[model samples]
Target: MSTITLNDGSPVPWLAFGTGTALYGKDASDFVKVAIENGITHLDGAQMYNNEETLAAGIKASGKPRSELYITTKLKILEPGQTATEALRVSLRKLDVDYVDLFLIHSPSPANKEGKLKALWEEMEEIHSQGLAKSIGVSNFRVEDLNVILEGAKVIPAVNQLHPYVWKAAQPIYELCKERGIVIASYGGQTPIVRAVGGPLDAVLPAIRERLEKTRGEPVTSGQVLGKWILQKGAILVTTTSKASRIKEFLDTKNVPDLTEEEVHVIEEAGEKLHKRIYMRHVFE
Candidate 1:
């Protein structure tokens, strides 16, 4: 597996496995084992997912040493009269881990965004300095909100997890994070295409078939093509599924093809013109 070094100089696998609402119970357990066996060392989870128990079971079942895995979990924004530090402690208990490799502020909800992010970020910095988390980051933050945090931040965020796909490049925020030496970890890597007019598989297969028929090219799946594009863009790609087969397919990084610069340019132009977003919300409003 390819790797990206965090601002803290810690190496994380480029293709991390995510656990969300869809991954649970036996399915998650099997998928986790399959992913690790297939060379995936990074795992992403969140407090809001409500599947940390099952995720822990899967990790224990995999029997991979904790040192071999890069586990990430998000801190839930606190409710009225609640505190961010308390929220993080609750997440830590649910994951059954004393420390996480990375901890991200899940979303800039109203509860945490009405000038509370500055305090939350300060708490995160304290967590890192105290060795409770190896790194800290934010998810779904736009450029403006990012600037708010950066303005008062003593510790720079190491990662920005956001929705990024073929039709949603998020270039402004991507560029901003790059300027600040932050790693951009992308979800929805192929989801937009997968959930498009045709299924994810069908969408790419026909194009490959057409290209082969026209130019005598070899075959490749849409998932692989999309994954390769994300790698080319210099962001870590994250995906989650309950299927063991699917997890194994994602971990099959060998022989992955690269997108030509022209092809990449075409994708960027098309994506920019489309401007589609699956998860849209105002962070500071």
Candidate 2:
């Protein structure tokens, strides 16, 4: 897997095993072990996941030295009167780790915007300075929100993890992050699965699928095509699956199919035309 160097000079693996769903105890431990065994060097978690203990146990089961893995966690924005420092401490206790490779602000909350986020950012800078976290970042932040943080920030955000799938409305933010040297990590590569499971695949309508199939010279599913497109666009892709076999399938990016320049352009144009926001809209608003 390729690695991207952060502004702080720390290298983070491009592919990460994201554990955002509810999984705890033995189930979480097993999932982490399977992920590590399958060559995943990066593990993503968050305080809101509510399964840090099991995530830690899975790390222990992997038997890989703690130094060998890039562990990432996030701070949930506090309720009124709560502190970021307290949030970090609770995350530390739950994960049972002395330090994490990266810590991100989960979203741009009201608390986060009203001076508290600056306080949190400053505190995160202190954490980085004190070696509790190697780097700091934010998730679901638009370019404008990012600029707000940048104004008061001493440390530049190393990563901006967001929902930037091929059929989504994040191209402008992706371009902005690229220009600013911030690595963008995308979730939701399971467009096909969503379609198969009777969920929406809005941008990948039947006509678009037919066009992609004709261009690619194979019956390409929207998920695979979008995943391939994301890689071609130079963004790190993150995906998760509950089924072990599906996880293996996602890891098999070895023989990545290529899309011609014209084909790529067509897809990009189609994406712009049909893009829909997948995740909840509260973050962007």
Candidate 3:
């Protein structure tokens, strides 16, 4: 799998198998095992998903060495009197690992609303200092939230994961992260194909796929087209599905032909015709 280098110098897999959404609050053992067996080396998990133990189970079932897998989990709001270190230790126990490749604040809502985003980030820095997580970051963080943390932050965030469709492209956030060397990790990349199927992309994706098929001499789906678009834009993709074939399809996206500049423009223009935000709307609002 291709990798992206974080600002902190950690190598992150460009495509990660996310253990959320469909696997949320459920036993992810079977699905996670299947994903690993099919060449997915990066696994994205979280405390909020309520399935870290099951994710561990799947990891064990896959029989891949811990050193070979790049594991990541997110931190939820700290409990009463609970330190970030304490919270990460809990996640580490659940995941049965000494340290995670990456750790993130699940959302900025709690800390931002409580007026403790800076303090929360201080604690995250503390977690990194203690060697509990190789890298630390924030998810669903806006430019405002990032500013709050960056103002007092000693360690620049390694990444900021969010949904980045063309409609809500998050250009401001993208620009800030780019200036600061923070990589953008994208989820919900297929919102146009899955959630809002008949948007402007419908008219454009087919032709792009046909062109890519001729270049690569293979079939390409709209989903792969979107995934390739994300990859081409230099963002890590966190994607998941219950089906093995779908997992293979997503993995195969690495070989899909890149989108031309006009094709990318067509996608961006189509996305602008309508607005859609499938997950974490409050973060953008």
lDDT scores for all predictions?
0.73, 0.71, 0.90
Superior by lDDT: candidate 1 or candidate 2 = 1
Q: Per-residue lDDT tens digits of candidate 3, residues 1-285?
A: 489999999999888999998888999999999999999999999999999999999999999999999999999878899988998999899999999999999899978988999998999899999889999999999899999999958999999998876445587888899999999999999888888888778899899999999999888988999999888878999999999999999989999978989999898888778778877777666
Model 3 earns a TM-score of 0.97
Ranking by lDDT: 3, 1, 2
Per-candidate clash tally: 0, 0, 0
Query: Using TM-score as the measure, what is the rank order of every candidate, best first?
Result: 3, 1, 2
The local lDDT score (0 to 100) that residue 264 gets in candidate 2 is 73
Query: What are the TM-scores, per candidate, against the unseen true structure?
Result: 0.87, 0.83, 0.97
Model 3, position 136: C-alpha lDDT score: 97
* Residues 1-285, model 1: lDDT tens digits: 368988889887888888864562234666677677767789888877767766777788888888888999887656777766677777677767888899999886653447777888888899989788899998888787788789968889999888765344478888899899989898877764565544333333455434433443444556766676777777888887656677666766335555667666655665554444565345522
Q: Native-vs-model 1 lDDT? A: 0.73
Model 1 error, position 149 (Å) = 0.9
Whichever of 1 and 2 has more TM-score, that candidate is: 1
Q: List ranges where model 2 is wrong by over 4 Å.
A: 22-27, 79-82, 112-115, 165-168, 192-222
Off by over 4 Å in 3: 166-169
Give the winner by lDDT: 3
Worst 10-residue lDDT window for candidate 3 reads 163-172
